[model samples]
Target: MQLAQLLIFLILFPLIAAFFLFLAKRDLDRAWIVKLSALTIGIVSVYLLISTYDKGGLMVSGIPAEPTGMIMFILEMLIALAILYLGIVHKKWLVVALIIIQSAVMLYFELVYAHAIHVQSNLFIDEFSNILALIIGIIGSLICVYSLGYMKFFHEHHPEMPDRRPWFFAVMFVFIAAMFGLVFSNNLLWVYFFWEVTTLCSFLLIGYTKTEEATNNAFLALWMNLLGGIAFAVAIVYLAMFGNGIMGLDELLASGKIIALIPAALIGFAGLTKAAQLPFSSWLVGAMVAPTPVSALLHSSTMVKAGVYIIVRLAPIFQSTFTGYLIAMVGALTFLIASGIAISQSNAKRVLAYSTIANLGLIVACAGIGTYEAIWAAILLIVFHAISKSLLFLSVGTVEHRIKSREIDDMNGLIVRMPKIAAMMVIGMAGMFLAPFGMLISKWAAIRAFMDAPYGFVFVIILVFGSAMTLFFWAKWMGKIIAVTSDGKNIEGEVDHSEWAALVSLAGLSLITTLVFPLLSTKLLEPFLMENYGHVAQLSQDNIIIMMMMLMLLVILPLSILIPTRKHRHVSPYMSGRTTTHDMRFSGSLGVQKKTVLSSYYLTEYFGEMKLKTAGIWLCSALIGIMFVATALQGVIL
Candidate 1:
């Protein structure tokens, strides 16, 4: 009964809420619906977490299979038809063809190939699923709540555009539902169904504005994901044909030894697209044009996450193979290049987007390594990155609202303009690369894990350089925000409380999670690792102490800014004796007063998008080609 209730709450509740939110007409109605739904989801997710913690894990089987499979099949068909319609309307023949092919392939597989396959357990619950549920239900719902405040300003900023807040909120809830289903299901077919739902939701949300650019970018996202969907479909077919009746994730994992290389390679290819790894990363970068909450949801907690989640799920199967090595190298290359590219970007959201890609690359690398420690690092990265990135995206969105720009230069001395949000941004930034934070700890573990792998030095080199690039870009952004300049504006009260609530909660989660890293590692991550691998990876006590010390600095540094301080003396900039004003200005040779200005060094000439993107895309494409060729060769040999 408890399992049934929890499952319904986690999987079904948001969907029901989505229907109500879609019908909501007034702001008041949307507000109540979003708040109530968020609250309910949050409560249920926490309850589920507590229950999972108490039980260590839970697995429910013997669900009525026929009806569920039929429903999933119908929904998949509807989603494909919807995509086909959009493709035709947009005149995107590639999308239309891909959907048609995927639909036909899925139909034949479901109706013919998998007609007699009886997957014993359709739903599986464990620590990993529980963690993802917590992320999707809690962080995802918070983003929904954040959207409530953000969409108002969004429309205000673009009065010329039609209001689609109802549709937007409804899709957001639907995304949460889809994510819940994606993580919880053990059956591959069910996972694929939810996967398509997320793809559809992202398409709808990305194209919400319906501008030509939004439409084009949405189609790009569509066709690329459709390509992945085709790969996923092929993988399912291959699995059904060659898997010796292995129909579910558990069975596949259990029978990892005999699984064919083709399905794994196809699935990895699918994951590459979903995670927005190089070659497919342009879609995520383009996603910034969508609303900030959409960026937060897609990049941080939902869409791109599904990509890494699938790769990580299949990690055990890919471990130690030639295909695995290629996947790891691809991830490492992406990490190095994406971080380098971030150095050239001035758009704050784009920087965040690139950083997200880089971090997901690291996670993918860890998954490909597929050792106990590597998988541990991957899961930890997932948890930490989701919290920290969501906070940063929300912070950037709020900052954009205040300054009317998303550029790093525009954020100069944000310490003075929006001190509270700046402080939150600082925490979020520090969490991304600084010590004592979850991301840094996860990276540290990843480095160690890579060191233990075969031919690990190559990955180590990429990771080292990538970490340096990460530091360079993040520090520059941090300096821009916290810089003390005379020309500062105060814009504190302009932001809504709804935004503040979500930001503060995420900021708090970042810090608290950092503080409790040891406990989390011990209780959640360690047990999961032990249960799966029969051993647990341990962090050194000395490192733990250092992490605690750094965490203390993280807490104090932000608080120092918030608390009033009289100990420091203020001084004006030391201009030459020819100073013309109290502000930093100087008398020129021609007797004209010139205001002083400072800007970040972007080095666009060296690290420009045009310089790096094409080369990186080709390199990653070549690597993917190698992966597939090698997989095919292996299959032929076997």
Candidate 2:
């Protein structure tokens, strides 16, 4: 098929499937439909990548304009009406006001600014977007497939709650479709439309249960993202009015920061909100009340990723400017504060959530630097974080269904109860932790880039300290998963096949992506960078060798554990005083029988979530205030 045809298929087929899935209430039929749609989407994404890579880049032409534009406008109004209805019905006046402001801005922009200016390329593809497309298509579809099993089990567990799998699966597909549109959209207007679509989908999915808390959290998400949406609309209007009427991404970038930085700052502010930096992070934490699959999709592949994609896309304009420094500082503070907060989380998903925020902060910081090395590092972080974080979230989901809790303390003996899921979770943590692993090489690259940047010391200090704190939380969680015990029984056999399929696929992907790191850099990443920076970033031969060597050590160390060892006399595990081999019991006062218990040291006094998060919000709010004032002053001079 032609490239445009494939783009159309990739974008439209999911919506078609979503409609069908919404209608089909039967369990068996929904399963087959999701599986078929997922396979087709995943394959077509690969084909799209090959076609785009062959051409280096391509833009779809002859796209139906007036009719397509009209359809989008109608759809936009419907979305606004839906959100407006939800807001008013729920007595969420703030949400109502925000949606009205954004919708009004959109209408004004469309009638006054958008109509006269013609955008020849509404959809385009390049190597960078291809990477995001693959993540959305493959990883995202896998998440949907996993949801098939998870939602069933969820319903079984919460028999008190109504089954909303139809709505759940349909919204998941729509989210995937919107993401595909967002990454491929060349026109700023088209991007905004898709952006709002994701916001709507996330709101629906987060509140799928219709429970009071779920509904409240969903509205919180809606308002925060809608705030970002309003900023996005204003940015587009600013560009249209004063940016030589340039609404296409390429045209905006060509106009340089002289014309684009102000709007870029506006959109960058939007990115900060969506990406869940500092104060905005409460929305994502609230989203955890939704199904695990929704959390995985939002945190790993779709909503938050879209936020950073915009920042990274606009990196060129922010390069060497105060806007970049402002972004870099926000990202830096976020990384440090979020990492500290993760350490205090006893809930496994909350730990993952904080980690996601912290890592995205690092990626945002890199994008803000906008150096060749930093952009390179930023993309790598995006790729690996998606795979490993998905695996971690899904693994935790499976564990939760079996163990009946997401508390890290409850999972103390997960290694004994569910080896398969536990092992995957361990690998996920290890891959993201400090080691010869997937996330490490990327941060190393970021460190190299930061070392050369202006105010480099500030970036370096935050990254180093924050990364160490990152290791602390993940190691604690990994320890819990791998902790051995005498009480738990094996339940790995009970995992649903669909969930296993996704978990195994993501786990394998995590390994494969690491194994192919060198080839990926030389073949895919470098060539892509050549287009923008006029050269490619490279690690020295020594550093490359060390990474490969460490990767080998990671492989060998695992195998070493699996290798059979010579039999030796059984010895009791140490538990304070004298311990018996059976039941992990130790002698206490008067030789009374006692069972020993070990718990993680959360250090809540130092890294308390409420304290640290509150401080982060206030500090980050101040930083954002400073940036806005500074950016507005610069704009006034023009």
Candidate 3:
């Protein structure tokens, strides 16, 4: 098939499948349909990549420039109206004010500023695009597969409700389609359109359960993203006015015209919102209230990626701006803050959510650095984090399903009840936590990048401290699960076949990828970086050896089973020198024992929602204002 057609198919296959699957309803087996759809999308994505391999890039001519812009304008107005209606209905004065101001700004910019906007390359593919496509396809497909198993169990647990699997899968497909569109779009306008589509999908998906918390979280997500959409719209309008028909990404980068830092800062602001940087990070953390699969797919793999993908794409354009330095600071700070908070959470999912935010923050910081090395690190981090994190979440979900809880304390001896899943968790955790794994290597790259930057010294401190905190929490969790027991009956391992299939595939992937890390770095990732980022670093043998040694100390050698180890005697957790048989509770006066429950040390009094909301809103608003002021000033000067 032709490459353009293949690209279209890759973008549309899931959506089309979704429609059919939704309509099929009770007549179809939902798992089969979801798996089939996922497979088809993955296959098409692979074909598209192969076809576009040697070709520089391709553009499609079917969508006209002028009409696309007009359509986008109308869509923006419609979405704004919908949000306005929501705000009015919910009596959220803040949402109303934000939306109205954004709407007015967009209207004025479109009417007064937009000039000739033309892009010859409509559908361009590059090494970065290929990497994104691979991630979206492969990781996304695995998430879909895992969801098949997950949703079945979910419905079984909540059997009273009408099955919404059809609608859920349908929206998921559309979400993936939008992601593909976003990555392949050369034109900023098209990218924005896809960006809004993802926002819509996330809103729908987050609210799928229709519980009060789900609905509220979904709205929060919507409002936060609407803020981003506003920034993006503003950037688009200004770029069109002064940019003089330069909308294609390659053309914009080549122009080398550094307008005021703030417009691009606005663009970066939009990215932070989407990436869930710092104060905006709560939405992603709250998203854990939704289905585990959604968390695995959106937070771990695809939607969040869209945010950093934009930052990386625009890295060169914003490379020399003060806003650029600020972007790096924001990202590093986010990494530090989010990781600090993650250490306080014992809710397994919340810990994963915070960890996700921290990792993405690192990726964003790397992109903000805008160096060849940092960009490479960002991309590699994306690749590894997606796989490892998704696997971890899925495994956790399975464990939660069996144990009926997500608390780390409840999972103290998880290795005994669910050995296979626990083993997978260990591997996944190692991939994320251990050295020589891609995440640590990428982080190492980030530190090197930060050290090279004159102004990012503070960021290095934050990064180092934050990383240590992350290790602490993950280690605590890991140690608890593998806590030794003298009883021979401690190990009881049994799990469903469907669950095993998904878990084993992901776990195997985590291990095999690490074993072949050198090849992956040298072959696929390094070549792609050279082609796209224009500079290359030696994948030094010494560096790899050092990482390998660290991996031995942190994960590999410790985990390698030697001489069928006997179980150690179980002992009560240390508590003020008291000993008791009860796992959590301790003996009191006269041997009268009181159950002592452990909950995560949520430092709400300090970092609570109420404490942070006002500050977050104020800071983001100020940032938005700075963007506009800078843009207006640049406009007057130019």
Candidate 4:
């Protein structure tokens, strides 16, 4: 089949499958439908990659935009209506107002500024979008398959909650479909339409339980993302009115800083909100209240990635401008502060959430630098972050199912209790910050990129300190996993086949991607960079050999723990109060439990969530305010 035909199928088939899933109702039927659809989507995506790997931006054609625009406009209005209805019913005036504002802006733009504009290309694909397509189709489909077992267990565990598995499965597929449409659409209008669809899907998924907390967090995510939607709508109007009739992302960016700065800043602000940086980060953190699969989908491949995708694509215009610096400063500060905040978190999901926000900040910082080297690092960050984070989130979810807790303290001796999953979880953790893994490697590239860019020293310092905080949190979690507990019993048997399949697959992909990154850079990233930026970034041959050596160390270090060694006397840790002998437990005064417990030092006083997040929010909000002020002054002076 032709590329266009396959692209259409890739976008539409998931929606079709979703419809069937909603109607199917039965567990076995939903499972089969998800598996088949995921398989087809993955295969089609791989085909698209194979066929188009060597090509430049291929402008997608053959769709009738006139009819399509009308359909999309109607659908968007319907979505707005739904939100308006819900907001009025729930008394969330903010949601109602946001919808009304964006609608007014878009309605006016479509009726006035967009009437006669012609886009040379409504959709285009290049190596970057190709890679994104693969991530969404492959990783996303795996998550869907994994959800099959998870939702079953979820319903069994919470019998009081009505079974909404059908709607859950349906929404997941729809989210995938929206992400595909988002990355594929070059026309800003189409991109915004798909973007809003994702926002609605996420809101639905987050509020699946219909509880008060779930509803609030879901609306939190909704309003935050809708704020971005409003900014995005205003940006479209600005570009159409004063941007030489720029209506496509390509046109807007290609027009350079002279024409793109103000609108680009607005759009970049939108990106920041969607990516959950700084002040907007709480929405994603709160989103952890939903099912773990929802967390995985939003953080890793689909919702948040869309934010960085657009920002990274605008790297060219962000270079060496006040707007760019504002973007970088926000990102850099977010990276540092978020990492520190992660250190105070004991909940496994919260740690994952903060880690995600920090890494995304790093990617945004790289994009703001806008060097060829910086873009290289940003792209690598996106790829590694997606694979590793999805693996970790899914592993944590599976662990929670088996162990019945998500607290870091609850996983004591996980290696002894659920060895297979513990090992897999450890692999996922190592991929995040350890040597020879893609995350560390990408960070290395980011460091080098920052070394030569503007204000390089400041970036380097932020990265250094932020990276240490990441090391602190991940090591703490991995320690909990690998530590042996005498009370633990093996329960790996409890995991379902579908869950294991997804975890093991992502874990394997994590390792394989790291091993072949050099080849990946040579074939995919290098050529794309050479074509687009006229320069290529590469690690030295010596560095490559050293990385291989570290990879060997990664293997040897894990196996070395199994080697026979002299048996030493185990000693009980001393506590001031009554202590249990050799049990790693102690009873103390001041509400201490009867059992001795050694918990990780959270330093909440120093790195508490409320304090750190409050300070960060105020600081980043100030930065954003200054960003717009600077943009206005520049516009006036120019």
Clash count for each candidate, listed in order shown: 0, 0, 0, 2
Q: Candidates' TM-scores? A: 0.98, 0.97, 0.88, 0.95
Q: Alpha-carbon error at 222 in model 3, in Å?
A: 0.2
Better of 1 and 3 by lDDT: 1
What's the C-alpha lDDT at position 70 in model 1? 91
Candidate 1 vs 4: which has more TM-score: 1
Evaluated against the true structure, the overall lDDT of model 4 is 0.88
lDDT for each residue of candidate 2 in 533-575, tens digit (9 for 90 to 100): 8879876779778877777777654344334376424356776
Model 4 spans > 4 angstroms off: 557-596
- After superposing candidate 1, which stretches have Cα over 4 Å from the reference? 54-57, 567-570, 576-580
- Whole-model Cα lDDT of every candidate shown, in order: 0.88, 0.88, 0.75, 0.88
Give one digit per residue, the lDDT tens place, for model 1 in 431-481. 999888999889889989999999999999999999999999999999988
Span of 10 residues, lowest total lDDT, candidate 4:
555-564
True-structure RMSD, every candidate: 1.4, 1.7, 3.8, 2.6
The TM-score, computed over Cα atoms with residue i paired to residue i, of candidate 4 is: 0.95
Per-residue lDDT, model 4, residue 504, is: 83
